[model samples]
Every structure is written in structure tokens, then in C-alpha cells.
Target: MQVELNSIWQLKDLDGLNDGLYRVLQLYPQDQIVIVFPLVDSKTLQRPIKVGFEQLNEALRVGKAHLSSYELPYYQLQSEANISASHLAKRNEKYSLIADLISSPRFLLDLVEQPRIKLVSLHAKKHNTYVQNLYRVLNLYWKYGQEKNALLPSYKNSGGRGKSRVAGTKKRGSPVQLSCPSFQAPEGVNTTESDKVLFIRAMKQFGLKGEKVRYSRVYDKMLKEYYSDELIAAEAESRNALIPSYRAFIYWIKKLFPAEKLIRKQTNQGDFDRNKRGLRGAATDHTEVPGSCFELDATVLDVHIVSEFQRNHVLGRPTVYCVVDKESRMIVGLHVSMEYASWRAGRQALINSFTSKKEYCAEFGIEIEEDDWPCNHIPQRLLCDRGEFICKDAEDLAVPLIGHLSIAPPYRAELKGIVEHRFNILNEKLVHELLGTTKGRSYIRSDKDPRLDATFTLREITKLLIDEVLEHNSSIFKDLAKQSALIIESNLPPTPLNYWKVHVEAQRHALSRVDEAHARSRLLPISKVTMTSKGIRLNDQMYYDSSHSDFNDWKVIARNNGSWPLEALIDHDNSSFIYVRLEKESGFTRCNLMRESVNFSHRHQADILFFEDWIKLEKSKAKPTAKSIERYQRRNQVIKSAKEELAQAPSLDSKSERTNGMKARRREAILAQRLGEEKPELKQENSFSEFDVYKEHSDHKKQKVVSMLKRKQVERDEN
Candidate 1:
């Protein structure tokens, strides 16, 4: 019988229970109960009991107890009774009902006055029983004052050691315990110990390593080779026997060669080396301080998104590049796009780590304060894997701007565990809960297709990511800070924002005004361009500004050559301008595209890619529409107009090529001119062209004719 814990039982149901009111603490093969008496200490009732009968009867009459109800409980006891001290105590006569009933005043008085009141079994009317004689033994219990002496029968050898047994009666002895058996070697048929050794060795050689042999084939071959002297049985009872069973042979093979050892023997050295390295401590100690170290990595976001420009078109997964500060375990920067992890995406993520994110978040439609993500400082060192950071382009772009750049060994991700763990944290807490999420692996995902369920566009996902990152930064790091000594040193609340505030002042790589400009320019994607009078060319467009100091510096470096190749850096997020470095100077000059309002209207990289792809798709058709051609023609017209304006303007001579005497004369004339006086406007026709030498034909045509004559003269001279 079983009773539930903390439940009220009826008085009639208390017949089989112990004589006390009990609170059910646990239930299993037997009930675990505690007495609920108001006068006694609850600590004294800490010991569990099998039953409490009188306590239950009193509780049913009172209706309720002072103790609170147990809401949830678990009961786990042994399924089978084993010989323990508690079980032996329950069988003692002191707590037994027979002793209680016999010791009652009415039963004792009746038994003492009438010696003829015979003991008989209640269930069987004709037979006397141990229960009926309990009354007669109660008198001896008062004299002995001990349960053992009172319960023992008067007859010797109580367990029937020398008692006579009936002819049909069955005998029983003390029970023996059962347990699992030990392993034993299986003997081969018709083989001695030496032959068995040879057989086992042959089995291992044929099937264990190198080239594997089918166990069925080994069994068949063994049967054919049996009865030979080298493979003969030695036992007398079964001297000549058949081959052992296939199952038994396979079992022995498994016992001799374990799976783990076999895999280690067959696998390559690289796998073993990786496993050994993973067991050691981290190769880097980046938890010194916030902004002292950062890790850069990229992963495909779990949710599928569509192009913001095209609603029906399903863009696949977006690659999310993250830059994580090692000490605070906070994401310093993140960039999301359709491009895979490369130098382009890596540089963007790197720049974002050092730049204020307020405007970046605003561009994605999220309004966040700057202090919420106060991680806009240059880091002392950058850590990355052997992907983009190993490339020459990444090194050239990052090495000059940052202090130290280190790449972890191939196939070792634990070195950059900070960023990798943040990716996992984002996927679990944010991505998995959103719509169109793959929810990780196929076996783990539900039946719904992630691509079909996609509803958010790339723009929408960017906004969601901004909000998620902001929440992650501000949220309490209760578990992480409790374990990290560096985070606890901040002496503030355990959160990324709080930790950063306490430690940001200690950063050694704080950026100055000039250093900040240099860092931003270096992280932008670079392009080689020829410096023309109009400016540097990029993406089929010319970016120019005469007021730029770098333009004058570039002239000094390329005084002899009309045009020289120089690297121009571009901001992919803002196509409004570019930054170019002078060949002779260290500073960067921002150059705006010549006619942005007409042709390249300050569009982002995503829109540019869309336009290029759209043109390609239109051209792939058999015939393109007039509108498509007109759009292409309009773009070309704007570029052609900017060139015509630049060509018609007066060319300025290189100041570096001018003599010192000529510079002095020009400076005197500029000083003599009044500040407010207007200079005379020049007409389209030149006032001095009337006296020109080649006025009859245009100067260009005259130069062409002279070039023809000169070529003929050179040909005759060569002949």
C-alpha cells in the first residue's frame, strides 16, 4: 500500500497506517512520513517513517494542519527490498500491532482472569496462530522490558534447525545475492591453447586494421581449417569439435580491440594533434582589459531574408561579421550583408569597432544612444582566424593602423572562442525565436521550410540585429561576470556596459583627432586610380575637389608625369565621397563625386549591386526594352557631361614645376588685388585668339596635320 505526501487521508483509511498524524514527505515502495505535532520540533520529525496511524486520525478530525503544502515532490526508493538496518527495525516487535493490541488493559485483564481463553487464528477457526498467542506473551513483556525477549518463542532452535519435517513439506535456506558475471574467453573448436592464440592473432591481423576483412568470411575460413593439428581441440569430453559460432568470434574481436583504439590507429596525425591541443590552456590571454584586444569573425545568420529592393525575391542567408571585445565579452561592432566573410566585410567590421555606432544604427531605423554601446575605441591588438586576416590585402590595410594583429593556427577556433561564442549566443537567444529561422541543423529544426517562411527583408533584419545587440550589451552578465575575474574588477554592476565604463579609461590605444581619421581611411576598401586634372577615378566615376590640400601634394609628387597611379579608398556605406592619400603626405583628403545629384545619387553598396544585377538580367534577354536602354543612356550622359565640363575648364600648371621667380610675381599680383573687387568674367571666345598662329584651322586640326607630316618625314629618314 502507498500514501501520497502532504495529502489528507480519511480516518477509515488510517487502519493500515502507523498510529500518528503524519505529513507525507515522500512515497515509494513504502510511504515516507513525518509527525505534524504542534508541540514537537519539526527538526525532530526530519526522520521519515513508513506509517503514522494515530496522527492521520487526529488530523482528519481537525481538518487541517499549520504546515504549508508541498507543491512538487519526487520519490525514488529501491525497487526491491535489501537487507538494511531500517528494514530490520520495522520487523521488530516493539512497533508491531500485535504487541500494541496485546498490551491493552482490557485484553490483559481478560487474559489474566480466564486462563481458558484459548488462542486461535482469526482467519482459520480451527487453528491456533502466533497472532492469537501474542496476548499470552504480553505478560512476559512486562517482566522482561525488552522486545527481543518478548517476541521470541519459548522453544529452542527457533528457525527450525533441528525440527522434524513432514514428508511433503519443502525446505528453504538463507537466500544468496545476485550480481553480473565476469567476462571469460571463448574457446575455439578443435583447437588447443596454442592453436587458439594463433587463431586470435590471425583474426586481429585480418580484420582489425589496415584492410578490413568481413567477419563472415573469417568464420567460413576458420571452419574449413578446423581438424588440422595446428587447429585441433584439446578437451577430452569434446576432443573433436566444429568451429566456434560467428557471434562468439565477433564478440571476442570486440573485447580484444576497442573502437576508440582502432580509430586512433587508423586516423591521420592532424586529427590527433588537434585533439591534444584542445586539451591545453588557451593560446592567448586577452582578458587583460576592454579595448585592449578584439576578435573578428563572420558566420551565416540562421534566418533567411529577402532583398529590401525586391519583395518577392528571396535572398539567401546573410553573413554577419562580428567584432568582439575579449575582456568584456561584448560585441564592439557588427556588419550584415549578402557577401561572404572576406577582406571587404572584415574591414567594414573592423572600422565599425572603432567608430561611433549611433549613426549606423539610425541608418537601419533603430534609435539608440551612443553610451548604450560605448565601444568606439581602437583596440591594442586584433585576433582572427586564418581566413581573411591571413591575406596580404588585410595585412596591408590593418597593420599600419593597429598595434598587433595575430592569426590563430589552422583548424583551431578555440583561440578565437570569444567571437564564436557570441555568434552562438545570438543564434540561440535572437535568431532561433524569429520567423524564417533554420533553427540550426536539419535534425533539430521543425518541418517548416525556413526559406518559405521568410518575411523580413535585409533592412528589417539589420534593424532587428541592432536592437538585439543593444539589449545584449545592457543586459546583466550575472553568470559570466561571476566566473570572470577581469569583469569583476570593474567594481560596478556585472554588465558589459558597466564593465566597459569602468575600464575604458585605462585603454592605451585611445584615438586622437588625426589618428581617428587615419584609422577610418585605412579600413575603407581601396582602389588604384590615375590622378587626372578632374581628380581620382573610382567605380566609373570621377571624384574631385580643388580645395583639397592633398591635390596640391599629389602634384608635387607627380610633377613630371601628367598622371600618376595612386590608391583611393572608398566608403561602401556612403557613395557620396571617397578618401585619397597624397603620394608625398600622410593625411587623407575627402573627395566627393563630381555630379552626384544627376548620375550616382549617393546610393549604398547594396543598391549598386542591385542595379548591376538588374542590368545584367535585362541584357540576358533576347531584346531589352526602350526604358532599360534609356536608363543606361541617361547614366552615360551624366558621366559624359562631367567630362565635357572638366575638358573645357582651364588647366592649372603644377606649382612644383614653376620657378621660384615666377611664384614671387604671382604672389605680388594676388596681394595687389582688393578683397571685395570682382574679377572680369571671361567670354567663351578668347580675346587673344585673333592673333593666334594657327587661327585659320583649329589648333587641334593644325597639330593633327603637323603630326601626319612628321610621321612621313620620320619614315623617309628610316628608309
Candidate 2:
């Protein structure tokens, strides 16, 4: 009896294929019939049928069948009279089981050969747990069987046994050595736990002795227990390596290849160079505004804050701020202070520059007629970038305070070349040279030992910066500033500064801090107080009271409210209130005298001016009334009870000669402080005759200068 299959029925044995085909063919009409199939590899289709490896066999093409389980090379069917595909497929084509291939039992019986009375034998394939190895099972009960699983046979002594080197019954505490076995490694072998267990079971099913796997049994145990999914997945992918779909490819790749290899495949060139150029371009343009540009940066100077002059006690590296002028190339107002670089520091820098500029103008024989910003008359401008210290809150405080200032675009540093160029020079000549050639990043550390100060002191550095700026402004140092200004004045049609003037005049009034609004606010009160760091309002205009710590940025606290007798309210935080300075020198003097008066007997009972005056007045007065004496006694009792004061007063005249020197020194110090005159350094030696110069001078030059100084006669005798 014979049955028919299509041109592409690939199989490993005829046991199932022959019976199925013979049964199906007998159900077809008595004549030969045909079926079509696609070309494919049979091994690939061993399980659920590999679509990519299908094939059309010529045996099936000839209305016959072959049970060879492999693929054939061909495409498209040749002759197909009885072969009809699934109703939806193309005519005369392919391996769609369009019709029933497996016949019924009755139909298959009718085609059987009568003489031999043959019945078909079927080998059914099913998925089940493969239990081949039985040694592992036997080891569970037999200790000798378990011991037999070792790589090296265990040695048994009279009393005890030593563990084997390769085939230990127990696991090692340290890392197990890894090695390949003597046997050939399995193809598509999963070097994982589950696969190892399966391999052991398979060997047991055959009743084999300990069969050495290609990899270590220790690793196999680890893989079986800990890496089942990975092992299964790896085995599946190895078995399905020929699949065409992306899912199949990825599954295999994930198992066989490292993750980094996939990443490398995804990335490309050309993207790297583009990013590098963008970063470099960003660092060059450091600022934002034009001539209205100033770089206000803070750093700690190379000095400790514990010095006698700086005991006010600020924290960390005491900060120093600088507002650099673009055009003048000058550090206008620099604060070597503890405070942050804020709007206040910015104002200080601007005010400092203008104050110095005023001096400059005065030197040039141009007395300022109007105390205006000189926006037009002086042709001055403020230039800087957008920063908290320079233009905080978007210049909410800066623009109005710095009159006639123009702001540049953010990050457009080339527009403010004056400052940038000056900073470049500073970096090359000052900061770099100071910090050290190796200090690539520009930073100033306030350490006791700063490398920059080896040749330059703090005072010297400040002087050098100032002198450099002055030299820049002068007809010296190559005259870049003068040349640039001249070139702008001569060419470029009109520079930004010159052209900006037209726009500035329109905005100039708005830039002033002192105006109608300020006047109504009572910003103006008095003007005669020497202009200083604390700017006071007077006549709707702010004036610098020079008496208030000239070069320092003072946080001037005002007292009570804005009123008469304006003074520095030094101990308050409210800046809006008017400052009222008490007569410090006089109060100080009185306090000192009172302290002396308490110890009058210490001076040999002789009294000083204030104390003597008090005593004389007391002695000359009439005797106190009963009520007055009682009140005085009560006050004395209270004073004595409150403090553990001395019992007796001092004698004042005991140190008369010593007192004269102190008095003279005090008087001189007071005079010098008030007059703002500097004194010369006093030499330790008193060898010089002060009157010798007077004696040498002509009558016209001398003429009893200073009542013919006391040293005159002494000098004459010595000569």
C-alpha cells in the first residue's frame, strides 16, 4: 500500500512519514496525485517548522514521496494537477496543507495490503523531563556512590579519608579553579546549571559512570541552580541561529555577544567633532555688555583676616571684589572685603571710578560746573556684562545708579574688549605670574603662603594695578587706549561709544539716582559734610561724605529717620534711617578724663583740666542743703554698692612730666586725624638738631618761624 506526500515533506525517518503519506494517498482518487511545497532545510524545520529553510522536493514533484529529513534547492512548482493550495493562496503553488493529509482509520485500512496484513507502527514525540542519569539518584541513598562522583579517587586511611583534589564531595570555600575537560565540548552546549543537570540526567538514563563534561561540574551546578532562564535562552538561540527574524537575531546576539559590542554598532562618527567645536566657542566670549561692560569678580586676597587691621571677623577666605572698567582699563572700586560681590560693591566701584575721574578732570583744568553725570560733557560710559554684582535683577539697581551706562548683548565679550583685553594682560602679567605658571585656572587663594606674593606684597599688587591703569590712560605703555580712542574718533564712521551718546541723552535722565523722586523722598538734606564712602542725599543729589572710611565699602546704618545733624549711624542695620554721629572725639576725651578722675589720688592728688574744674566748682559752691546732701549721699551709696570700685581717688600730679608727653602726643594725633595730614616715620635716634636747618636758612626764609623754635639756641651752642 502507498500514500503520497507533496514535493517538500522533509523528515528523518519513514516510520511516521510513510504511514501518514500512504494513508493520505489511498484516500485520494486511485490515480497518481500531486502536492506542492516551498524549498527549505528540514533540520531547521525539525520542530515547529522553520519558514526560511523550507523547500520543494523533486520526489514530491513527481507525485512521489521521499523521507530524507533535509532541504532541497528550488522555487515555484512545475506540474500540479491534483495539487491545490489553501483556498487563499496563489494557484499551482505551495506547502499549505490545504487538504486533509492524514486519512481516517477506515480509509487507511482499505488501502492496506491483504496478504501481509501489515499494521503501521507509530513513534510519537512528546516534551517531558528527561531522566537519563541514575547515579545522582543512587547517590542520594549510597555514600559510596556519592564518593564515586569525585574527579580524583578519594584515599581512605585506616581511621579517616582525605578529600580528593579534583573530585571533592564538598564545595571549596575559596574560588574554584576553572578548566576544560578532556572530552570534546558539546555543540550548542549550554554551560549553565539547568543544562548540566540535564546532561547528568541524560548520562544516567544510559546508566553510565561519571562522565566528565567539557566544563567544570562545579560551574554546571552553579548554572543549573542560578541561571536556568539564561541557559535555556542561550540553548534556544543556539538552536535557532538560522532564523531570519530580527527577534531571533537579537536573542542570539544578546546571548553570544557582550552588551558593549551592540552599543558600538549603534554609535557613529562625525557627531564627535561637532560637539567639541561648540564647547570651545562658548568659553572665549566671557561677558555681555559693550563699553557698559564691567567684570565684577570676587576672590580672596593673600592675607589672613586675623590681622590687627581686619579683626572685625568676616568668615572664610575674606572676599575681594573688583569692578573693572572696559575703556579706562582700570579697577575702579575694588573691595578687599569679606562681603559678597553684590550691587553695593558694584556701586562702590562705579562711585570710586567717578570720584577718581573727578580728580582726573580737575587735574585737566576742567572744574565740573554741574554735578551731573557728565554723560555728554565728559563723554563717559559704563560697560559690563549681565551679572548679579554688575546688573543684578537685570540692572534694576545698576542702570539708574550708573548714569549713561550702555549694556551689551549677553556673552558678547568682544564688544567689551577694553576689560577683556585688560584682564588678558592681567592674566599674563599679574594673575598668572602671581599664582604660578602651573595654576591654569585663574584663582586667588587667601593663604598665608601664596606663590604670587613672593616678589609682590598686597600693597604693592594694589599699587601696581592702579599704576598700570594710570599708565594705560596716559600717553605711556604703547598708548593702546589713546590710539584706540583716537582711531574711533577718526574712523569707524562712529564708534559704539560715540554713537551711543545720542541714545544715551534720551536715557540719561532716567539713569540718575538723584532726581525729582529722590528729592521728594528727602534724599537731599546737607552738603557741607565731607564727601565719603557713605553717600548722603542733599538737594535731591547723593554726595559722598569723604569722612566715612574713604576707600572702604561701608554699610552705613542711618539713625531714627532722615533729619538734621546727619551722621553715621554705625551700629544699625536700617540704611534708610538718617545717620547721627555723636561727637566721638569729645565724648572719648570726657570718658577718658572721667576714668582718670576716679583715680585722681594715683596722680599725686593733682587734677587735670576737667577733673580740676569739677573739683574747683564743687569747693566754691555753697554748702549743700539737707535735702541735697541726703540726695548726694544716696547717689554715692548707690554707686559704691553697684560696682566694687576703688575706695580712694588718685593723686594727679605724681606723673606730671610723663603726662606732658602723653598730652602732646594726643594733641598731635588729634590734629593730624582732623587735618588728614600724614606724619613722617619717626627715627629712633635723636641725633639731629631740628633747629640747624632754621639756623642755616636766610632771614627771609626763616624770620622766627614758629616763634624761633626752642631748638634754635641749643643748635647755635652746639655749632
* TM per candidate: 0.48, 0.27
Per-residue alpha-carbon lDDT of candidate 2 for residues 471-551, written as tens digits (9 for 90 to 100): 333322333223234434444333333323333443421122333222211211222222223344322222323333422
Best by lDDT: 1
Ten-residue stretch with the least lDDT total in model 1: 70-79
Deviation in angstroms for 621 in model 1? 4.2
lDDT of each: 0.61, 0.35
Highest TM-score model number:
1
Number of residue pairs clashing in candidate 1, backbone atoms closer than 3 angstroms, sequence gap of 3 or more or interchain: 13
List candidate 1 segments past 4 Å from native: 1-278, 281-286, 442-449, 478-491, 506-514, 528-567, 574-577, 580-586, 591-604, 619-719
Model 1 agreement with the true structure over 244-312: per-residue lDDT tens digits: 455556655565566665555544555555553335554335355666678889999999887656766
